[model samples]
Target: MNSAIESLTLDVPDTAAAQAFYDEAFGLGDRLRFTTTDAHSAGFRGFTLSIVVAQPANVHAFVDAAVTAGATVIKPVAKSLWGVGSTLQAPDGTIWKVATTAKKDTAPPSRTVEEIILLLGAADVTASKAFYVDRGIPVAKSFGRSYVQFETGPASIGLGLYRHASLAKDAGVAASGSGSHRLVVNGALGTAVDPDGFAWAPAEVRAGA
Candidate 1:
């Protein structure tokens, strides 16, 4: 399947507030849709939005900006075994993990955040993998019973799964019960919803003149 996570659709208490935060902090600009109306009434848990960067400076810059944008600072930016890192809770309640891996070459037009990986916490990783596989989303990598990363293009935006309890612990939040996700994946699995409630919708086709 030619699938990629184009942007995240989060259910925020205030759309304008959420959009302003993302735009100011990460330069996401119009890449995020924060809506006050919709299925946002359901509380979200069981997932994380990861921002992987190539440099420690980028990580620090992002964390600093997020704080200035009024995000709840969950963990202050610091060097950990993983790399320079930090955590924040968006005004809308989405947990964001900002960190850096080994340094790599990055050209101009560079942004503070590099790649966005949406990791869903599943009750059963195997079952989740099978569900997507049946839908034609290829597996790029998998580790026995622990994790699975779906095949996506070089754009670096993709989907994956992990054990629910384990993921919740790692994110410093309690395991959440199943509910709707503020996410949407675009590609071959047009207009479908996963077992976990994540949506895979087709891109809108506009009329020609």
Candidate 2:
């Protein structure tokens, strides 16, 4: 009844071998709660998994106990990083992992968000790159066939091809041509014009030549 879900870990593949390893490494004795299945194999599921070779007689007893506790064993127990795991859905509708833990390694997926790239989708990348270069910005990389990235002091700007139809679809605005983007740099309101005749530069431009 506690709020947190304690991970139910399982051992996989060779139970005796994995148990031996754990016994030596972590000193886990009698912690191996053997669940029986009707088949000659004990499957892993719900936070962990394992592929267990039964004593050939207690399979049905294990399967019945699990089912009575609202555990659904959905497939053949197979070997994995823990031993063998079988897919089982918990009573709460959450797909719980039931795997047999062995000596093999397992790595989860992960990543880091460094920065956000502003996709300034454009029509002409070559000309656009030239425009940014003239404006005191350095080119980082060309986004292959459709866009390019320019270095922004602490951030990065992406230049993408601007298609009128696609842009209209994207913004859900009635777009005949490119729209205006207002920018506030160092306390001044600036405007930039594209294919459309929109007011886009600040009245007072920056102080450097």
TM-score winner among the candidates?
A: 1
Number of the top-ranking candidate, with lDDT as the measure: 1
Local accuracy of candidate 2 as per-residue lDDT tens digits, 1-209: 11011111232334454455434322324422222223221211111122132221222333334455555666434564435444444332222222334333333311111222223334555665665567555656665544455555442212233333443333333333221222111211144443322122333332692
CA RMSD (A), model 1? 3.2
Q: Could you list the CA RMSD of all candidates, in the order they appear?
A: 3.2, 23.6
Query: Model 1, 1-209: lDDT tens per residue?
Result: 33355556676678777778888887765446665546533434778888888777777778888888988887777776767777788877888988887443354323456777889888789988998889777898999888999986665466889887887777777675545566666555678877666677765444681
